[model samples]
Target: MTEIVFTPIGTVHSPFSDPRDMPIQPVGARGVRGTIELDPACAAGLQDLAGFSRIIVLYHFHRSNGYSLEVVPFLDKTPRGVFATRAPRRPNAIGISMLRLIAVDGATLTVEDVDILDGTPVLDIKPYVPAFDAYPDERAGWLTTTSGAARTMRSDDRFC
Candidate 1:
């Protein structure tokens, strides 16, 4: 396989200073607030972003140390393949969260519903359009069994 590299355009800041204290997913992070500080060169890309109610942030889980083919995710007790869950200990340490846009000033974005760790490297941001991104009925695989438990779920160092 060929190697690839990515340079972060910004960092995510949230109350989650420790990986163990962060929300595992957006469903568990409602009302939490955070911000993104983009590099000056990426400031211009923030244009027209304020109009979107929600934005998808693609970031790197810089704190995650290694990969595991199988993991016991937050919601379930059984171990499953890494790709089957949103566990952070993947071959590629990346994370994505959909946050509500509160405001944007230059390249700084104040957002809510944050699930990522503080100082996480941001790879990209995309506006979340309901028309294009939302689906009324979707199958969640094994996650279906623990869907109701997510409201209080938070991440831990197991995957970090």
Candidate 2:
């Protein structure tokens, strides 16, 4: 397999300095505010992003050390396939979040409902178009059973 490489287009700035006690998912982090500082070289790409109310942010989990095929997720007690959980530790150490776009100024973006940690390297940003991104009737697998727990769950040392 060929190796893939990505350059950070920006960095996320949030109140979360430590993983512990932070919301495990965006649903749990609702109303949390943060900022994205896009590289000046990529500032031009922000041209029409303001028109969108939300965006999909792909980022690197820089602080995650290793991976496990199975993990006891924050939302459940039973060990589940890592792919089934949104745990930070993974083979790629990558994470994605859909955050509300509050405002766009030059190379900076003020966002809400942020679950990402501070200083996270952002790989890509795409507008969240409901028509193309929302799945109103899709099955959520195990998530359907434990999603309620996610709303009040917080990160711990388990995955760290």
Q: Which candidate comes out best when scored by lDDT?
A: 2
Candidate lDDT scores, in order, read 0.91, 0.94
Over 1-160, each residue of candidate 2 has an lDDT whose tens digit, in order, gives 8899999999999999998999988888999999999999999999999999999999999999989999988888899999998889999999999999999999999999999999999999999999999997999988898888877888998876
Q: Give the per-residue lDDT of model 1 (tens digit) for 44-133.
A: 999999999999999998988889999999999999999998899899998888899999998899999998888899999999999999
TM-scores of the models, in the order given: 0.97, 0.97
In order of listing, the candidates' clash counts read: 0, 0
Q: Best candidate, TM-score-wise?
A: 2
How far does residue 99 in candidate 1 sit from its true spot (Å)?
A: 0.5
Residue 59, candidate 1: how far off, in angstroms? 0.4
lDDT of 2 at 118: 98
Clashing pairs in 1: none
Off by over 4 Å in 1: none
